[model samples]
Target: MVLEPIYCPSCTSTNIVKHGKSTQGKQRYKCRNLDCSRSTFILRYSYLGYLPEVKQRISEMAINGSGIRDTARVLKISPTTVIEELKKRS
Candidate 1:
């Protein structure tokens, strides 16, 4: 099996280890980097990302001239994916 690198969302560090599962059963990871402030994180997409309302909101935000970070913060998606989606729409 191939292992994919898991990065800390806060520090983008690859020095992470499996901590445990969240209460919701998602896999949680712990950052080993001393400089990293975040202790644990879940690597799965949030429930909000799957909602139709959020999908629509992303498009609406794009149409309103919101940047990728703005849409990602408001709709809770990755900025790279947001840029890709907006590129396809344009």
Candidate 2:
């Protein structure tokens, strides 16, 4: 078996542990690093909306004059996701 190293996305620490499965059944991992702000994360997200980076992009696209549909299409996420994120910012 090829052992792949798992690193915490928040702190880039190798001290990771299997936390549990996400609602969608993705393998979730936890960072053992005491300074980590993130609780749990999956190495690969099945949905674009689940990624923090994508959420940031959603905010940026909105500020940069991209419409909801435009941001959804560009980011390949749901229009509702874009709208929800924008709503949270306000």
Candidate 3:
């Protein structure tokens, strides 16, 4: 078996360890970098909206006059995710 290198998404640090399993049974990892803002993340996200890049895109789409349903359909995420992300920005 080959071991894959896991890096923290927030800090891009390799100093990470297994934290626990997510609700969906995905392996959760914890970042050990002191300067990192985010603590834990999963290697694979089941939802596109759960990704940081996708969240940014959601905001960008909203700023570009995209409706919530449009963004959700384009991004392949739930409309509720778009709404929640927009709410967080406010």
Candidate 4:
């Protein structure tokens, strides 16, 4: 079996521990860094829209003149998600 090293998304600290399971049954992790702002986070997100990389890509696609429907199709996410991300940026 391969062991994966989990890091805190906020501080990128490897000092973390298993907190509990989210309502969606995803594994939750707690950051042990005292200076870290975020307390708990999930390593794997079921929704593509919730991932930071996807959000960044959405912004990049928009900047490159991709429409909402095109961005959604390329990212395999909802057009509403693309719209919301753009709204948040503005």
The digit string of per-residue lDDT tens for model 1 on 1-90 reads 998888898799999999988778889899999998878877774566544456668789888899889889877678877776667667
Query: Model 1, stretches more than 4 Å misplaced?
Result: 49-90
Error of 3 at 52 (Å): 1.0
The CA root-mean-square deviation of candidate 1, after full C-alpha superposition on the true structure, stands at 10.0
Candidate 3 clash pair list: none
Report the error of model 4 at residue 14, Å.
1.0
Name the TM-score of candidate 4: 0.78
Off by over 4 Å in 2: none
Encode model 4's per-residue lDDT on 1-90: one tens digit a residue: 999899888799999999999999998999999999988889889999988789999999989999999999999999999999999998
Among these predictions, the greatest lDDT belongs to 3
Measured by TM-score, the strongest candidate is 3
Please state the error at residue 66 of candidate 2 in Å: 1.1
| CA-lDDT, candidates in order | 0.79, 0.90, 0.93, 0.92
Residue 73 Cα positional deviation in candidate 1, in Å, after optimal superposition: 14
Candidate 1 clashing pairs, residues 3+ apart or interchain = none
The alpha-carbon lDDT assigned to residue 50 of candidate 4 equals 84
Work out the TM-score per prediction.
Answer: 0.50, 0.87, 0.93, 0.78
The residue ranges of model 3 lying beyond 4 angstroms of the native Cα positions read none
Score candidate 1 by lDDT. 0.79
Which lDDT tens digits does candidate 2 get at residues 1-90?
Answer: 899899887889999999989888989998888899987889999888979899999998888899999999999989999999889988
Better of 1 and 2 by lDDT: 2
Better of 2 and 4 by lDDT: 4
